[model samples]
Target: MGTSEFMLAGLVPGIAQTLDVSLARAGYLTAAFAAGMVVGAPLMAALSRTWRRRTALRAFLVLFIAAHIAGGLTTSFAVLLATRVVAAVAYAGFLAVALTAAAGLVPPDRTGRALAVLLGGTTLACVAGIPGGALLDAAFGWRAAFWVVALLCLPAFAAVSRVADTPAGGVTDLRAELRELRHLAGALLLAALVNAATFGVFTYLAPVAAGVAPVPVVLAAFGFGCFAGITAAGRLADRWPGHVVAIGGSLLLTGWIVLALVPGALVFLVFTQGALSFAVGGTLITRILRQATGAPTMAGSYATAALNVGATAGPVLAGAMNPFRVAAALVAVALVSAVAGRSGRPAGPGRPSRSRRR
Candidate 1:
């Protein structure tokens, strides 16, 4: 699913040529997927609330696979765009359900690690899948990449079938989930702000590093940093989520500022920013899950929505202003938000404090 979501960027030129659409129009396919994720996360979670986790996951994979196949075979740009949205909706629901189920499989103390493992797939996609898709498109065609993604989903479907059919717990009421979301508004906001900072800089990274370093090397550095950050976050977040957020946010803010001030350090700053961003991001996710124990079925959906909101908004925000400076400002706001949330109240009503949890 992660591969399918991101691989489209590399194939946009080919798609535009084949469909006789403008490059800008072909780019809408990416935005459409993000929009679908933002809308579909909560929508699909609500619709599938009554099903077993395993069942919901399988159902989503089926839809996702069919959408990919349909997209690959379609010659009409409109039909292809519709298939992207459908696939994104399935991807959103599968991600939400999978995260919730992954957390359930682990003990409370190990929840951070479990979430990290699940999120690793996405980071890996950035590091590898995007390039692989490009290779496939070069050797075969753009449609071949879509077909490959559909084929990959088959194994995922079979794997999900073997997982335990855990009941989707917690109150199934949408009203109840909304109430939980209110209590979680602060954490969710923090998640959005941090990702906005991350993606705002990342979307413009190639141009930002124009002469300082090769694009491929700069991207590789950032991807490697993401992998390292997530690996460390899985362990640290379990014990010191607050500290992780504070320190990671500070580093991210500093990295962005340095990049803005000294454009020559673009490569190094991109790596540090990526590391700090994902570290804070992973910790924030664990924090949200801990606070949303009462809304187990909807927690992942809320997180997905918040993250995609940032992903969609970040590029638009960056496109309007100086990307690095904009990113730095966003991270500063996120840090302030995190600090205020920590100093104010507990994560949510009836949740245990960190001291008590330990």
Candidate 2:
């Protein structure tokens, strides 16, 4: 969902130009998709309370296919935006339910490992899908990208069908789950801090790259770094689940700080960004899931909500300042990661008791 959400972002300007509209109006297409996700994620989680995890995943893929088709066929810009909205909602639903389900597939000892793999699906999509979509859009048209997405969904749907159902059981008590999360205030605060810090710099990655290198080369480097970084983080988590959060967070912080200060050294900046992305990308997501497994479904849903909140806020935060000023933001992200690491001691044996005092 995240990859698909982002894949079309690069095309928006061109799309707007083609439609003969303002860039801001063109940008609304992206917003419409996000709006759909905001509406769909929780609703899907709540509705799928009775279904097994695998079942929900397959259903979500089916929806993905349908939404892509809708997007491919649309004519007017408004219709395209509406299709994107529907696609985002469907993607949100898939994400919310899929993570909860994935957690049930592994042993408690390696829950972090399992969650890493689940989240990896999205990361991998970003790695391969976004660039691939861009190339396809360039080769065919922006509409062709949607057709490709629809085609991609066929295999995903089939693969999801083979995974055995492992239901978390009982209808979700979303209200009660929200109430439980209040006890983990420290973790939540840390999550917000991490988001603000990381995104502050990341939202303006393009500009930062432009300052250091040409746009095309910098973007390619950034994508590669993110892809490599996310995969590496997942490996680190599997190898030493306890230390990944700290190691990853620290590296991410350092990377951003470097990129912000030395905008002229493209090679160094790319390496830093990749390393930082690798560590932080894996650490933040995996850690959040680890903290929230007590109410896996609701926790996953809430985590997604927090992610959206961060992504939405990042641009607002970045937009308020000169792009060069973002270096400070990366440093702040590192601090948040460090603090979160301090509090993120792993739970042993059974799920951490929600009733136990934090």
Candidate 3:
């Protein structure tokens, strides 16, 4: 699913040519999918009360597969955009259900490990799947890459259907989750900002890399950093999560600075862009999930929605900014996390602060 979601990154040039659109307009392909996830995540949670988790998963998985095929076959840009939206709906639903089920599949002591494995699977997708898809897109055409992802989803569907059990997540009160998100205003704002900064660069990496290095090398580096960063985030969250987030945000800011200073220096572009990718895809993703501590049933959907909302906005925002100026958003992310970490510090002798409890 992660692979499918991000495969468009490498294919931007090819897609732009195929659709007769500008590279920036081609970016709307990503935003359209994110738009669907924005709506689909919450809708799935609301619908889950009556739907069996496994059945819903299977259904969504099938829809996702079909949507990819349609995307691959379409020549019309509008059709492709519509197909992406449909695929995203299923993509969001599958994630929401799969994550909810994963937590219940283990004992309380092992829940964190179980959830980490799921997130790791997603990171692994970035490491291999998205980059590999990009390679295929470069070699063949973008549509051919879409077909490859469609085929990959087949085994995933079969494996989950055969091996996974359906765990019924109790009905999540939507109103309550909204209240919790409001209570977590600072965290949610940070999550959106981080996502916005991350996507702003990523969605434009194709054209941006053209001005810097070989497209393949840049994509591979970006994906590798994403995997490593997310892997580190799990370890960080186990100990000093607040500190890690602040540190990640600071690293992200540095990455943007490097990009601004040396956008075309191959070595620096790879290193700093990779680092920026790491912070965005890894720790920031975990940060969004961390904020859902107050709402279990709505946690998966809420986190997904928050990120998607930013994801939807980022590409559009990037479209309007000079790539060099994209760094401005990361500066904001760094400052916000610094403030959050300070607030999370131990407040008194016996009592911990709200962020510390997180």
Question: Which candidate should be chosen as best, given lDDT against the real structure?
Answer: 1
How accurate locally, in lDDT, is each candidate?
Answer: 0.86, 0.65, 0.70
Give the Cα error of residue 139 in candidate 2, in Å. Answer: 2.5
lDDT per residue as tens, model 2, 94-116:
88777666666776556556666
Off by more than 4 A, model 2? 195-203, 238-242, 322-358
Best by TM-score: 1
Better of 2 and 3 by lDDT: 3
Instruction: Please rank every candidate by lDDT, starting with the best.
Output: 1, 3, 2
Per-residue lDDT tens digits for candidate 1, residues 1-358, read: 8888878878998999999999999999999999999999999988898889999999999999999999999999999999999999999999888888988999998988999888888877776666777888899999999999999888988999999999997456668877898879999999998888777877777777778999878877887787778878998999988788877788788888888889898865767777788989988888888888668789999999998999889989999988889888888898887777767866556656756744
Clashing pairs in 1: none
RMSD of 3: 3.9
Error of 2 at 315 (Å): 2.0
Candidate 3: list runs displaced more than 4 Å. 9-28, 73-79, 106-116, 121-143, 162-166, 264-266, 272-281, 284-294, 337-351, 354-358
Candidate 3 or 2, higher TM-score: 2
- State residue 326's C-alpha deviation in candidate 3, in Å: 2.3
Better of 1 and 3 by TM-score: 1
